[model samples]
Target: MTHLTLALDAMGGDVGPCVTVPAALQALASNPGLHLLLVGDPAALHPLLAKVDSALLSRLEIVPAESVIASDARPSQAIRASRGTSMRIALELIKTGRAQACVSAGNTGALIGLAKLLLKPLEGIDRPALVTVLPHQQQGKTVVLDLGANVECDSAQLVQFAVMGSVMAEEVLSLRNPRVALLNIGEEETKGLAAIRDAAAQLKNTPSINYIGYLEGNELLTGKTDVMVCDGFVGNVTLKTMEGVVRMFLSLLKSSSTDVGRKAKQAWWLTLIGRFIQRRLAKRFGHLNPDQYNGACLLGLRGTVIKSHGAANQRAFAVAIEQAMQAVQRQLPDRIAARLKTVLPKSD
Candidate 1:
């Protein structure tokens, strides 16, 4: 896309500048048209960039901040004490039109609270949802929403999530008329909670959504549908569980290959076969790595904000930055607003 600037809360994550600064440098190197405003204490940020190449430095600037939001702080507390904080500064930059979006690995509650207060939700959206992209059974992608944004949601909010997720899938993944589904206990119409069943009825009546009934936990990666909508409590637990399982499986594949290789060293035939199987397994499931999909966007707001994993390493943080760039390039907020205008429920 064209030249775009993004504000990054450099002091928000676990290691703060240690992770974000290098990630910023790496992102600048990869995307020549991108500029970054690193918001944090200069004392903490300058040293990290001191040895960097001057060309990269030209496109990056450091915006000074006096404080940072504690990772474990309550949302209300963080917001009340947010003045001069790195996260607040980064967000303010967006509100003032100096940046297209903000990316932070900061306190989740604080980020959501500040973003909603500053950027404001889209006119028809009751609340913004945290939506993420995941790889499907095939080469396609599936999008899930409310990944820890709102722990509890009403029927109206659930239907709103479906709309937000559908718009995001189209805008970010380039999908056409994407199939949407509710993450539920079972596929049967009468299976889930009252809110879920009510949302199901609402989705069924909305012709624009292309609602496709329910998706069980096991069916998430099956590519059965393009969008999975759920309240935050279930979605967050489900996402963490999926990540842990995928990691365990990938670890087992590697360990199996090593064990087989050691035991088969005396037999050339066995060694050759073991190597082939290892390569096949790795090729088949390598893309399932969770780090590659670490960034989750808070959708349905007036401006874009990408939430990177607080413990994300350099490569993962760069991926978050790239996601923000894509959202900005595609005008994500505007697209969702336009979609909501047409489909927002008349009441509720």
Candidate 2:
């Protein structure tokens, strides 16, 4: 495999250098051909670098940055005051042709704001949408978009998201004629907001996309459709809810095991059955672990930008870097731009 260079906003995450540096090192170890440009205060990163193997040190380079955008920073504040922040510098590496892609576990609003301002939107894209892969029941993955980037979207914008997301599913997920759907309260044509209905109508008429009409929230991970399109507010809420549910189940599984352990001494057979059930649940829910699906790509941008979960651990953060590498390798932005030219409405 050819080597790919990626820029990391080492100061963006909640734990800052502690998480980002180790994640970068892990990514480098996993992909021998991968090189990382770590952007942050050298003083904070140097100690971590010392722990890395000398051979790998050559593959990792630190780019000094003076500031960082807080996770709670508003978009406006980030744009106006974060010119020299690690996130901005990492993005600049992409514009300068020094890095193939950039990954950040920073403020979502700030990352979106800076990415659009610095990289600009792809031609024919009104705005970029946050897209991520979700594990599907068919032992496959679905590409869901507008994952908290645009809180509200017009009908045309929703249609545009469908177009971009379909292309992404085809190009990245390698799904041929990937099915598309609008997320709504109900699957009926008359249900949902006018924007969703209008977008559905547009998708149904559009010959290029495999629009499967509206899909209710229940069908999200069933592999019923390859792409789920919705406004950011709804998409974000749905994603977070699913994540919360997964966490809840996993927590319950852990607690149940402990409760069963004490009773095991009293009733060996019952404890054995309980342990069996716990193991099965763990195996099943392990697939839905958010860490495995940590990276969310910002689609329709001029260059590749991946947003990792802000609270991600090192292993999870490495997945985000890998996501960026995949996008760069596939030329995702160019592919979306080409597809949009043919499918997007004339007004756009």
Question: How big is the positional error of residue 68 in model 2, measured in Å on the Cα after superposition?
Answer: 0.2
The lDDT values for all models are 0.93, 0.91
lDDT of 1 by residue, 100-209 (tens): 99999999989999999999988888788898999988888999989998999999999999998998889888999999999999999989899999999999999899
Task: Write down the RMSD of all candidates, one decimal each.
Answer: 1.8, 1.6
How would you encode candidate 2's per-residue C-alpha lDDT over 30-92 as one tens digit per residue? Answer: 898999999999999998887678889999999999999999978897889987899999999
> Once superposed on the true structure, which residue ranges of model 1 sit more than 4 Å away at CA?
265-280, 346-348
The 10-residue segment of model 1 with minimum total lDDT is: 257-266
Which ranges in model 2 have alpha carbons more than 4 Å from their true place?
Answer: 266-277, 346-348
Query: Which candidate leads in lDDT?
Result: 1
Model 2 / residue 14 / CA error / Å: 1.1
